[model samples]
Target: MKVDSVTEKAVKAVLDKFAESYARRDLKSAMSLIAPDDDVVIYGTGADEKRVGQEAIKTQFERDWAQIEDPGLEYNWISISAAGNVAWVAIDAVLKAKVDGQNLKFQSRITMVLEKRGDRWLIVQGHFSFPDQSQFFD
Candidate 1:
């Protein structure tokens, strides 16, 4: 489906904010971008969990981030399409994290869905995959 330039730009702006938020570990800023009743669905080999509502996500991440150090995300926005009120962002990125003495890195490809609720866009769903241990994006 072809989207007008305006719709495409709008989607891009939201996606940019999403990436920057994770990079900064600014959960408050990220949560502000999401809709109040947003739902997030994540699909991966080790972590398969569906997070519903913005508050649930906020609570979970607040706790999760508290346990980590220098948690940063780098996302390459591959594609974003919008039809009416719903939009999807396809991304490939690397997540670098540290848990106490252990350091970890993972390559991730994810699709995030956002919905326009009133005057703002909210992240409603996300499906993520890790394609092999080798770096796929670089």
Candidate 2:
């Protein structure tokens, strides 16, 4: 796949908006970035976070925002590629938040597939995971 600057910029904008939703805890805005179809799916890091459709994804976002405080992310790096109207992105990030009155940070990895519909690029499939830092892997 070719890495088109124009397409990459558009995809990056959508990804940025998604991260902003985490910070602002705005479910409506987040949902707007996702495709409004049943095919939309997101496999989150949680063991039970395989969400499909808009309602399921919305519930997951709400649960996460309610559980964490001062949510933010350090977008370390991103790789984007596009073909036609479809774009894919892989990102390395650090999640920062306050949980149970304790400040915490965790490394996160995100991959998403977006489809350009009209003038907007909407996320149609996404998978989010925290890298396993187990000694066994080392």
Model 2, position 135, has a per-residue lDDT of: 41
Worst 10 residues of 2 by lDDT: 129-138
TM-scores of the candidates are 0.76, 0.95
Per-residue lDDT tens digits for candidate 1, residues 47-125, read 6344667777776567657767777767765677778988887888787779886888778888888888876777777
TM-score of 2: 0.95
The top-ranked prediction according to TM-score is 2
Residue 124 displacement in candidate 1 (angstroms):
1.4
Number of the top-ranking candidate, with lDDT as the measure: 2
lDDT of 2 by residue, 25-129 (tens): 988899999999997999988999999999999999888888899999778999898889999989999999999999999999999999999999999999999
